[model samples]
Target: MIHDQSMQRRRSRIRGLFGVTAPTDAPADAHTPVEGERARLLDAIRDFLLGNNLDISAANLLAAHTAFSGGNPRLRRRIGERIAAGEAISQFWLDQQLRDDGKSDPATHYEDMAVRLQSSVERFRDTTSSARNAVVSYGRDIASQVETLAREEPAATSLLREKSQGMAETARTFEMRLLRAEREAQSLREELARARRDATIDPLTQLPNRRGFEAVFEEEFRMARSNVEAMCVAFCDIDRFKCINDSFGHDTGDRVIVAVGELLKTMGTGSCHAARHGGEEFVMIFRGFTTEQARERIDAMRIALGKRRFVQESTGDVIGKVSFSAGVADVFAFPDRRNALRAADEALYRAKEAGRDRVEIAG
Candidate 1:
């Protein structure tokens, strides 16, 4: 799985480095002068950056321009900030910003970013003006050839053109089906993967369910034991989840759960896995971290979630906010995974008994 992720990242980096190559029927030997055009484009972008006193490299500037032109504000802001800061372009920083922003406002952000890409397009347009003219010239040349051929061999020429047009249409239809099939296949694969994930996930919150957590817990525990390493478990429960469900509709309650789940997943990175143990309860396994580390991480997550205002999706109404109480414990103290889970649960119970929206660690 790590290898697959690494491979995908490597492939993405490679593609990013090369830029996207256009799919074409043209032979490799066909000299399209696109490489030269690209070089000129890069040079123009560098000149623009230098001319504008935007402290960005050519590649970075190009990426920013592309993102802006593609209408991504997140990217636009990122590029803008880096240039403003006089910092070197950082792909990682940009990516983290995007991830932090998450799935919300993708279209709006991208559209705003695309505006910045106009400069790149303008450069391309200028460079390709000659190419466009040449294309027109070629069209005239083809028209002259067709006329002469029609006069010399009217019947044969007419039949040939008709056959060519029919073949082209047939090819186009086939290509469209191929594209559709590819899209459908990709969708099915994603659905199948989702189903498999769902099997290991809690249906309500869609977090890794008890079964998934246990399996992962056992593996991490074993690794920790063998290495004489420290591991921690943090059990969390949404404060007043039942009350919220009772007050609001179950649908709204479900949305809250999903939002909380997302928050946990993001914040629980240091904690190996975040799982919906059952009901409003979530369990986080801090695989290779000490009790203190896990506690700090969970505390940070608790604070972040407690502060976030969750809005209702359907009507764009604010649905108030939510918070969780968590309990952290060392796995080494437990005889088994179940014992560790129980210890975390007890701590969580103590947290609820005292006050919610806080972290309580097992002594």
Candidate 2:
């Protein structure tokens, strides 16, 4: 009851700030401005999530709630622009935007987990080392005392020596166990590191997944900012991918995905860093390249890729020519990295609208 009353008081203050007031005798069901706005926002968010066929997952709910409630002006603006520009708010795109804005933790979560695990391993190793040292020291002290006892008391020699030897064996056994445990801990630490790396890479493409790409981009973006360098990021998507899958089956789709992955991997060998952005889309970044230069390079790649013919391995029948469309944005053109990607995505939408199998530069 106290919390509800406090919340009501806060609402009243907010309403007063917005030039709204409740009458002295207003009914409980009265629709105040703040209450009405909240109701409308709730309705709008529901309509949006359901209408777009987006999952009702926690992240989506939080993002939508924050966006609709005007908590994040940039996210709200970006979502509005994408809608206005005829872009679908796909799950992948939403996840990308969330990651770009640092709202999502999926990308760096593995690293965070690894850090904690590594710290634990280090602590365990330290504890084991201390225990091992203590046992060894204890065993040496026992042996030294037993030898002195043997020298001083010849009659008690047999019993003292036996007890000392038993203690020495126990200490050795414990030390060996500790050593084995420490080795296992070290192996676990290495495995954790590998797990972190694996999490960031796409299994299908052996390319950096969205999270890994972000990690690379973050470093590059930071350096580009510090040195004031030219950089470009492009989004590449297969043209008529759905039609291909429907016509030829999903096996063909997987093959197409792999084929694109191989090309992007090859491109990654150059100055451009490439990644499979998810689904039929890939992302690439080029340093020391103007937006125009990047667009030309991407266009040439597209043309060359279009020239290649894809044949089904099993059927040996030629699948129709596979092609891709791309959108390039100058990293420096926008104030931040996310906006640049959004601009690139918008240009990609325009390219699709114009016709696929081409490259478009962001304005």
Candidate 3:
């Protein structure tokens, strides 16, 4: 009851501040000034609502509520008076939303998703390691028992032969167990490795998916966050990919994607990780280099991709050439990979917006 009363009191005060007095037995003309004030408040509210982020909106709303509660005694008195007169407060300022500024972009989503995938891979790794450990422990115990039996029964020749055969069987059993353990370990390693790779990489392009790029970004972020190491992240997408897909079949389009992936992988050989971020989008991370340096290096790859001739395997028809737009961000200045990822993404958007097949760096 107390909570409801408090909330009711709060709502009344909000309405009064908005110049909404209780509709009462008093003359209708009594609300003329209040109606005028309400119009002005609404105008101010609209202006405020137009330019707020969620955080700012929340802060301002709380401030408005607090001011309504304590700052205007007339408003407070009117609120109490309205409640006594049984007026219902109907309006609230909580539903307003500012425009989405896109602070949480696709790259951010990918990074979070990749982390979860990697954790699952790690669990697989740990489980496999435990199994290997158990196998080794059992093998060691059997080997110890076989050795002790051989040493204690050295004189009984036939018995000794039986012991020898027993020891050989034990050794073979141990070898088989060890071999199984090794194979299982290898399989587990491969499965976990594949899982980890799949988490971040696009299967088609073999490039880092958004998830993969995010992992690289985070690693770079941690590296930068810890030390003075520099990193560069680049966001790229095939130019006119949709047009190519539309003109040609999806199979040819897929071939182009695969070709680009192969070229990018070969081109990004040392200290660079490249991935298919999403759709036709690709991301690359270059370690130990300035954005300028990385740009120069990647520019060559861009040109190579642009100039490369791709023929439609079906008709042996020339598919013309492919090109890409790229945006590069450096960790030297930004330091945070998340910020760098965002920067690169924004730059890539700008590059695409300006013109295709060009490189743009984050300012």
Candidate 4:
């Protein structure tokens, strides 16, 4: 059931990306014209790329086809704008925008281990303390009985010695049990922490994935509401990212993504959080920034990215520049976190509609 739901969601996203509507009851043949048009556009894009010696990556081809099919007016307009800005449009340039994996940090692992060990130690200490107390009480009772036996019957001294030995042996056994429990708990805690970190991070980009972002968002939302402070959420999508993956290959795409991730990490500090939302989209949280301030910061990043150039190291070919569109929203202005995210997403759509490499603030 979960798999089916996931597949349906994937199909929905594909349809949305390609500007296809949900299926209707019409006969399959009724969609032939549309499919044929898409095919023709795809062929045309292929031919154009080949004629111009452009890199023919799948993402680039798809972007070109989508633009030619008139399915995505925003993408078409973005292409035109790039040309107008005196930037050379090529497969290499497009490939420079779309992009990935990784080992766990030793520091984080050690820190988690330390915390687990500390908790285990504390637990063991408590258990040992309780056991010690029990032993002390037992010893007191044994001593009292021995004293009585000594007074009532001096001949029972040998039996009293056996009883004291038994009590001492029991205390030793309890201490061992506590030590074993501590070891087991420590092992379990380490595994749990490692699993949690793996689940929350994107293996490819080494950035916090969607799940992690949601957790952070919820926490920030709660804090903002409690403090009555302003917070902003911004959604960013790389422009023509598909083209980058198509042109240079997935490896190059991965490099591009890593570069972007590093840049985001640098930008996301001082009460701000940045995460890879999925694919070529990223989301950021700004704790103290208003919508306008968030927009300015995002726009600045967009400009910075656009100005940076990527190069194919092996061939030393310039890959041109990459850009992104962003939308920023003031979370406090919305009724809930969900509403704030929706508002930011709508604003991002507007930014893309206006042009790529720009930022829009939700009103």
How many angstroms is residue 344 displaced in model 2 relative to the true structure, after the best TM-score fit?
Answer: 1.6
Candidates 1 and 3, the one with greater TM-score: 3
lDDT digits (tens) for residues 1-363 of candidate 1: 985664444333322322222222222332445554345335434433443334575545655454433223224333433444455544566556556443332332443344455444444544454454554455555556666777899878977576555655555555555455555545655565554445665666656665567677777778878888888888787888877778666788887778778877786554378876555667788877888888888888888887888665667767576888888888778555544655666577667667788888887
**CA lDDT of each candidate?**
0.61, 0.75, 0.60, 0.68
Q: What TM-score does structure 2 among the candidates reach?
A: 0.70
For model 1 the local lDDT of residue 19 reads 26
Count the clashes in each prediction: 17, 0, 5, 10
Q: Which stretches in model 4 have alpha-carbon errors above 4 Å?
A: 1-148, 194-199, 203-206, 313-317
lDDT of 2 by residue, 1-363 (tens): 986664455444323221244423222442675575556456546655765668999999988876656333335545655665556678898888777666322555556767888899889988888888888898889989998999999999999888888889999999899988888888887887788888788777788877788888888887777878899988888988878888778898888988888877666644579887666778889887899988987887788788889877778888868999898999888656766776777677667767788899988
TM-score of 3: 0.50
The TM-scores of all predictions, comma-separated, are 0.45, 0.70, 0.50, 0.59
Task: Give the C-alpha lDDT of model 1.
Answer: 0.61
Q: Compose the digit string of candidate 3's lDDT tens values, residues 1-363.
A: 986664444444444433354422222333565565445344333322332222345645543342232222112233333434565422332222111111212444455655665576556656655665665676566567656776786565456566556756665676566566656656755775665556555667756665566566667667655777677888777888878888888898888888778877885655687877555666788877788888887788888887789887888888898998888988556523444565676577567667878889888
Which pairs clash in model 2?
Answer: none
- Candidates 1 and 2 compared by TM-score, better number: 2
Q: Which stretches of candidate 3 lie over 4 Å from their true place?
A: 1-199, 224-227
Q: Using alpha carbons, what is the TM-score of model 1?
A: 0.45
- Per-residue lDDT over 223-242 for candidate 4, one digit per residue giving the tens place of the 0 to 100 score: 87788788999888888888
Residue 94, candidate 4: C-alpha displacement in angstroms: 28
Better of 2 and 3 by TM-score: 2
Sort by TM-score, top down from the best: 2, 4, 3, 1
Worst 10 residues of 3 by lDDT: 96-105
